[model samples]
Target: MTTQQSAIYYPAGEIEEFLPQIGRVVEIKDHELAVFRTSDGTIFAAENRNPHPKGGPLAEGIVSGYYLYDPLYDWKIDLNTGLVQAPDQGQVQMYPVKVENGQVWVAL
Candidate 1:
């Protein structure tokens, strides 16, 4: 049996404030994650996990065509890569997010 680590907690309200500015990437525990805006102003949160063992930091990574590139190893991984990064082998899970009346709602 495999044991999954504890899920990290991020205050949605605080994250929302940074959404309009430069995207913010944060790491909780050993997980790498980021919140950023596309060229079209759509905000998204994605895990920073890298497929390569020597994966770069996701917060400092780059996003291109729905994929995040590790800054250190230059590994191009899908934004939806979830907890694991692989070459068409793994997928990232997404949470339902929405902003209402100046409040951010992230379905856990």
Candidate 2:
């Protein structure tokens, strides 16, 4: 069996470089998260912690309206709903990601 391992690192204050690709996954502090771009060119951030065995990473989690999918349980939660998905949810943390002067900046 192949196990997926995560490499935790923070991209806080480096939003420019990472903003170009919408729906891309980035790691912060060893946790996986998703970076998405709306049709209006607005960027949104969400946690990519999947609880299912065949689920994908946070970046692969579904985004609909203001909620992001859990990929495992197929649960939906608000993107701005903070790091933890819910009480006892054990979701990944969501960080504030932004781009300025062509640079991606994540609030640590």
Candidate 3:
């Protein structure tokens, strides 16, 4: 796990405010990130940008299982590792997320 001590973590919002399988974009300074809560109740955070040629709007992308499928081209990115899966080679910045007392915090 990435230590929370290395960087400041900002509270995005209450965890319950985000709908399941929907990615919410959170901004801290100039960084734009997509935060997601899976249907099974797992939380993930990554860059809002998609790496594919025509893919974009990651926050509005579809969440399926453990991956966030890019809306433009259907490129699936692993939410757990931020790895762009198969045929795509690259990664989005994955932020360390912590939920404490129902609040979601992202380490930026």
Candidate 4:
């Protein structure tokens, strides 16, 4: 991992290795991140821990468009903004994601 400005970027993996619409768990420093690649090939990263009271892993959540349906409680979380959609409340900590030279990089 390397720091650029205020964020530290870590290499997650090759871009093609991340299947679209699937979430992958990546450990960067002490942070466990749930990284997702949307169907359109955009990458999004968020804390692996769920925001719900009975928290669980977000890596196994279902991805539909830009929203992630919490695996256990089914809370719809926006990947971009980390906001739990209306009818639900709370936010997931989000990280910046980017790809360079076919390698996926996540910032924390």
Q: Rank the candidates by lDDT, best first.
A: 4, 3, 2, 1
Q: What TM-score would each prediction reach against the true structure?
A: 0.53, 0.54, 0.89, 0.93
Compose the digit string of candidate 1's lDDT tens values, residues 1-108: 111244333445543465442446555445445665555545566654444555444566666555655667645555543433544344444544444555443443
Count of clashes, each model: 4, 12, 0, 0
- Model 4: lDDT to the true structure: 0.91
- What would the per-residue lDDT of candidate 2 be over residues 15-85, giving only the tens digit for each residue? 44333324677666665667765444456666654544454566665566556665556666566653435
Ten-residue region with minimum lDDT total, candidate 1: 1-10
Between candidates 1 and 3, the TM-score winner? 3
Q: On lDDT, who's better, 3 or 4? A: 4
Off by more than 4 A, model 4: none
For candidate 4, the TM-score is 0.93
Residue runs of model 3 more than 4 Å from their true location after superposition: 1-3
Q: For model 4, what is the error of residue 57's alpha carbon versus the real structure, in angstroms, after optimal superposition? A: 0.4
Query: How displaced is residue 26 in candidate 1, in Å?
Result: 4.3
Model 1 spans with C-alpha error above 4 angstroms: 1-11, 14-16, 19-23, 26-32, 80-94
* Candidate 2 ranges with C-alpha deviation above 4 Å: 1-22, 28-31, 51-56, 83-91
Angstrom error at residue 66, model 2? 1.8
Please state the error at residue 46 of candidate 2 in Å.
Answer: 3.9
